[model samples]
Target: MKIFSENITVPASAIDENSHVNNITYLKWCIDVAEKHWLSTAPKQFQESHFWVVLEHTISYKNPSFEGEELRVETWVTLAEGVKSERSYKITRISDNKVLVNAKTVWCYVELESQRPARITEEIRALFL
Candidate 1:
């Protein structure tokens, strides 16, 4: 599978009371990277007609990240079938290359206007390939 990666700097706003990156912040980064990957790889027409919605997310916190830390966020589509695709994510602290979070999210394709689940066409799947 092709992997999409983005570098993110841990911001002060992302910190929780514990002084580390918050759980919700990690999820936001996952979703942001997924959208960015799709937008950059998929055809313009496909992007215009379809959008994705998260169906589920499974995240494992392996370590903590602090403000000013540079992290690498990587993601790839693992499964694409019917109307759903599973995307995986890994966030690593750049300083030590230690993984801070590992996650997988299930997303369903939907029509832009109708907002109803839409089938994954061959053309769409080919974009990921």
Candidate 2:
């Protein structure tokens, strides 16, 4: 599996009333990394012709992360078939190597102009593999 990863230092704005990273922030990070991975891996023609839409998203929180902490965000394709693909995400705190969050998202591939579901082509699948 090809894992796409990036790191970010938690900022004050990401913290909420509980003084920890907000739940929505985690979701945002997951989406951001997924989009980035697709943009970096897919060819220009693929990029122009297709895009992904979220069908389902599941997230589990293991621990709370605080501002100033460096966290690694990673995502990879777990499954792909027909018109959809499943991707998994993990957010870990660097200092303790503790996983703060784990998430999975089911994305439906769509034709950009037609706005219709599209089957995954072998070339697209190979990029992830």
Q: Find the candidate with the highest lDDT and give its number.
A: 2
- Off by more than 4 A, model 1: none
**Residue 16 in model 2: lDDT:** 99
Looking at model 2, which ten-residue stretch has the lowest summed lDDT?
A: 120-129
TM-score of 1: 0.96
Q: Considering every candidate listed, which one attains the maximal TM-score?
A: 2
Candidate 2 stretches greater than 4 Å from native: none
lDDT (0 to 1) per candidate: 0.94, 0.97
Q: After superposition, how far is residue 56 of candidate 1 from its true place, in Å?
A: 0.5
lDDT of 1 by residue, 31-57 (tens): 999999999999899899889999999
Give candidate 2's error at residue 115 in angstroms.
0.2
Q: Once model 2 is optimally superposed onto the true structure by TM-score, how far is the C-alpha of residue 57 displaced, in angstroms? A: 0.5
What TM-score would candidate 2 get against the native?
0.98
Q: How well does model 2 score by local distance difference test?
A: 0.97
